[model samples]
Target: MYSPNFYSFVDRAKSDENGFIEFHNAYVSSKMTNSDLYFVLNRYGLDEEQKDFHIKISPSKTIQPKDKQVGELLEQRLSFEKNIPKAITLNDNIKPNIKVNAIEYIPQEYNHNSFNSPSEHHLIESITLQAHYVLKDSHKKNIQGDEQSLLKESIQRHKHKTKWGYIVFDRDEDIEQTLKQLNKTQPLIYSKRFKELENIKGEIVNIPFKEEWENKQIRFFAYLWRANRDVGWNYEYTIEKLRMELNHLTESAYAIFAKEFIRIPQLREEYQKTIKQISNEILAIVDEEKDKSKKFELAKQYSKEAYLLRNQVLNDIRDKSSEFARALAKSEKPILPSFESLIARKMQQNNFMGKFENLSLEQKTKVYRDIIDSSKNTRKSVNNKMIYYKVFGRTFAIATIAYVSYDIYYSDDRLKTAREHTNIIGFGLLGSSVGMAMAVDTCDINPICYAGFALLGSLVGSSVGNLINNATDTILKKYGYE
Candidate 1:
């Protein structure tokens, strides 16, 4: 009832040595859940013929002229999306028999992100590493310094890819020609007359940027032509050269470029044709419909078809960042001078990343440091202002004692001299002790007990101090010396 589409590959060396090929990297379309699809494949995967449960291979490439090495191994991302026989058992570890098919052979080019999807950090790291290998020989020939100098120079050598998307090289016009050719080709595809569609076809389309050679043009739109893993554009030097420059321009041409510049646009044009054809069909149906009652139902059916078709197209186009663009987005210029003014030479060329993604490593560090410092200052200010329960209780006690002493002995005219001076000195001591003994380490005080004690102490101290003051005043007033 169900079949799966897989992105598959073969490693001949491992197969020959191990005597069995595995489909570990096999994945279905992004639409299907892996758990559901793989469970079915693991148990029920069968050959195209359905006689034996096996993978029927199509010959992707026979010989690589550039590599000058010929073998059974075809560098490819094979897609499996056909009927398969039901499983004999439900075991997950069951292996299917190998079935092979041969076709016109094509060469494989290396795509960096063709394998396990890597994070931005990992992607940059991989690009820098590969660049190092490319530049190693040149570096050795040019540099002959001390070990420390060599290490530091090596650090400079492996800088991140260029930030600017466009660079002006002596051969830029050559690339521009190719770019223009790529842009103009697609509109022509969509404008094909019926006679032209039957008579003429475009060349096999592949992303020129992902090729091992410098960017080149292709004629036909190759649907789902994913590059193999291993190589990137042999323009590491070009990227490195452009990166080290202080004045590389951000490209607006890529935006200005016409519809056929990328495969996504071509797919869009194809869908546009499908939409127009469906609309024309709906009109024809309207003309033929004699029964007026059936018109509404027919209109609803046509609208439903249009909605489904458009949504499916959008799903195919959505969130699919240009894998080719990612491959072309390599640049390595390490020296970041003043980030405040680095907006012209900014590292990120697109809006693909978060706020931090656009910023350089230097800018991020500076922003975070400022945040930490501000936080520290805020915390310190809060801690200083916070009056802990113990501190508040002690201060209140000191204030009450001072208040009582002033009201009684200090204010009394008939009070003995010793009592007056001693009470003044005691008040001073109590105030000093209150300031010194109170801890204000944080904005928070301890438990409810401390808070309760502080509140109760304030109330009781005020009452007792007032009572003492009243009694002392009465005694002083009744005395003859008062």
Candidate 2:
């Protein structure tokens, strides 16, 4: 298991020289070092590129804050998406850092508004927030003496405070418990973790990603936190706060990442043989390319082509994901990701479901990659497209080939007149070409598979020849022209 721990707490951060809001009192537990939780959350955090802002404006423009354009600037910086946040900092990699500029609301007199905005307490210009990527650093435990000072400072700063507005994330109670139970049983292969995963996999196999399973997910993470309780987070500080924050944004991709990321370690032993074999094949091919300059040039061309294709694929993925996220955020009713279509693709690709008992950790990893990388077009759209070519293009070619092959091979056979041959060829058996259609459809198998088309053509030609022979016999007797 990857077994990375996660911990989150809200607190006031220090302002740097540039005066960006930096949270120091995350109060992360001792065992779960700042690095693990930091990297995991940052790995699955709301990416800057996916962050869309919903700005709140007040009508009382008269009593504005000192920084008039600051609010506008904040919106400009935060609202407009940037590239995906980087996971590692240069040289020093203790904790993954996000470079975001966040504004802590120092609220003053609140202006009230009722139209358009759901927020009743109008955000008076007194509170201005700056925007930057959030950065994570070393653990800063909130000391006992600091609590009172911090509270006093908060009240003093926002003396005329208006309303409490913070993003609250919640997950269901049952789900949290289930995750806890599974985390407890994670050590053994036949333990409850496997069972719970199966349950979740089944439950989320359809549309309307249900609430019950989401709760399970929450419980899973919560318990995963507790799994390292002795070394990481203890029950005293985190569990209650975790339980309180029940309504988390469920649609995000973090949980899926966490679940799949853990399975990576599980695949190491199972795939050793395959990896070694692939390495040997690669070495052999490279060794065969003895001409140094020629090999270098050929390799350079392939590398350049691969790089171009990768860029195009990544760009398309980002565009689609961004579009889907925006639409889902605006959706009236939201749910977890069912990912059924992705799961079906994985199952079909690896044939994972064919023999559940035979599945090893490596095969499981392959299946997981299939689902996770579906957006990246990991599998080709071959079979789904083959039928179309068969119907439209190959079917016509079947009959034409049959005529030419039969004429070339069997010109000595009894066919007296050109009219008779034409008449015979006119009645082509379109339906009898299914075998040829299937063969051409599976051209990936081998070129010989296309010989089915030849057989189809020959059958057609033979039928035409018989019709011509019989028809000529009838016409000669009836019209005396033959």
Candidate 3:
């Protein structure tokens, strides 16, 4: 007779709170279905124990007769005949209590074209059960009595709760034929088992089970299953999470640097203060150190940290500078001169040797040279041709207008002659507009340079046109048309 306590234990094991049933089902499927249990038992010297246990655990009359027959059929299908010659023989010690009312093993049906070509054989290779089982007193005693009790306990407690338990069978001509016969009679049961086994391997092993197996087998299985599951899930999750966090950090860094760009001089001053603090700390450490090796190590550490901080600050500055450039490109604002350039220009405006200045001539000259070099590099980096063409177009347009105005002022016949010249100048202006439009598409230049050059070109062209008109009028008055 089956023990009620054993059934209760199995119920608890299979309960939703603890997924013991799922785990045990997975264990049995992996070992029995794959028939790797024999090899595992042999390798770990549990062959005799496994054989004894297998006989004892065989489904009795207490289990449904149909269930027992199904279990037997699954076992037969999974058994390694070459390795275990006695696999087919029923052990006389353990009498089969359950009557075999009817036996059926069906393969799940699949659409051939869904996975492969219609001509290709689409074989249903495995069946799985989602089941719950209770631990027998003997099983619990075996687990507790084992030398590796901790490993046993961990496996029993943690294995197979969520998304656990699967059984797979190797395909054979006989098995396929049997499945075909079964499928004709009961399609629902066969389809259910097929769906249960599909893409289920590691999850089944994670479900907890009755700790009746040897300690070594339990440990090996538990460790292998956990490692496989972690590889599939945990490790990838960790790396992906870290990558996402790093991307977020990069965005935060940009935001901080953007704030610094708007208040650059203030940020530069703050950076100087940080550098001073670092230097002071290094000096204090150097003074306190007695041992040469220790001092060298400490100094090196300080220097490395300081260098890293400086590099971070520099990168922040670069990011902010790029942001500023982008903003200026869009705004077409007057390029505010660089801090050093502005200071130098102010000094030059006051005269290098001015009585009002505190800075020495040598200091002023050095500052001026640095500003000049910076300005030169900045200009070199800009697209000069684009700037030049933009300025030239605007200047030519203004010159066309001034020339027409001159024709009005100096014409012998006032309205008629002026109108005719105005028409000529209007054509020139239209040509200039087309040239400027073409120039705009030629390159991506700094917007500040574009605006500056355009304004400068117009002023210069207007001055030249005025000078030309005055000279023409003076010469014309000396001759005739005036």
Instruction: Choose the strongest candidate by lDDT.
Output: 3
Candidate models: Cα lDDT each? 0.31, 0.31, 0.35
Candidates in order: C-alpha RMSD to true structure: 32.5, 31.6, 31.8
As for lDDT, the candidate ahead, 2 or 3, is 3
Per-residue lDDT of candidate 3, residues 114-172 (tens digit): 31113212221232222222333344555545434544433333222222322222322
- Model 2 lDDT tens row, 1-482: 01122222234344469645433333323432222112112333232221111011101112123333322213111222233233212112232222222223211222212111122231112223222222223212533456545444333222221111111124333433443564574642234343222221110011112333332222111111012211111111122222222112111112112211222221221122223333344334434676765544443343333334333433332232222222222242233334444445566776667653366655544444333333223213432333443343323433343454466456664445344444444332221233334554444334244344434543665476576679678978798765
Alpha-carbon shift of residue 37 in model 1 (angstroms) = 18
Report how far off residue 286 is in candidate 2 (Å).
44
Q: For each candidate, how many residue pairs have backbone atoms clashing (under 3 Å)?
A: 11, 26, 12
Model 2 TM-score (2 dp):
0.17
Model 1 lDDT per residue over 342-386, tens place: 322232332324565566544543333232222112123323323
Overall local distance difference test of candidate 3:
0.35
Model 2 residue runs over 4 Å out of place are 1-431, 434-461
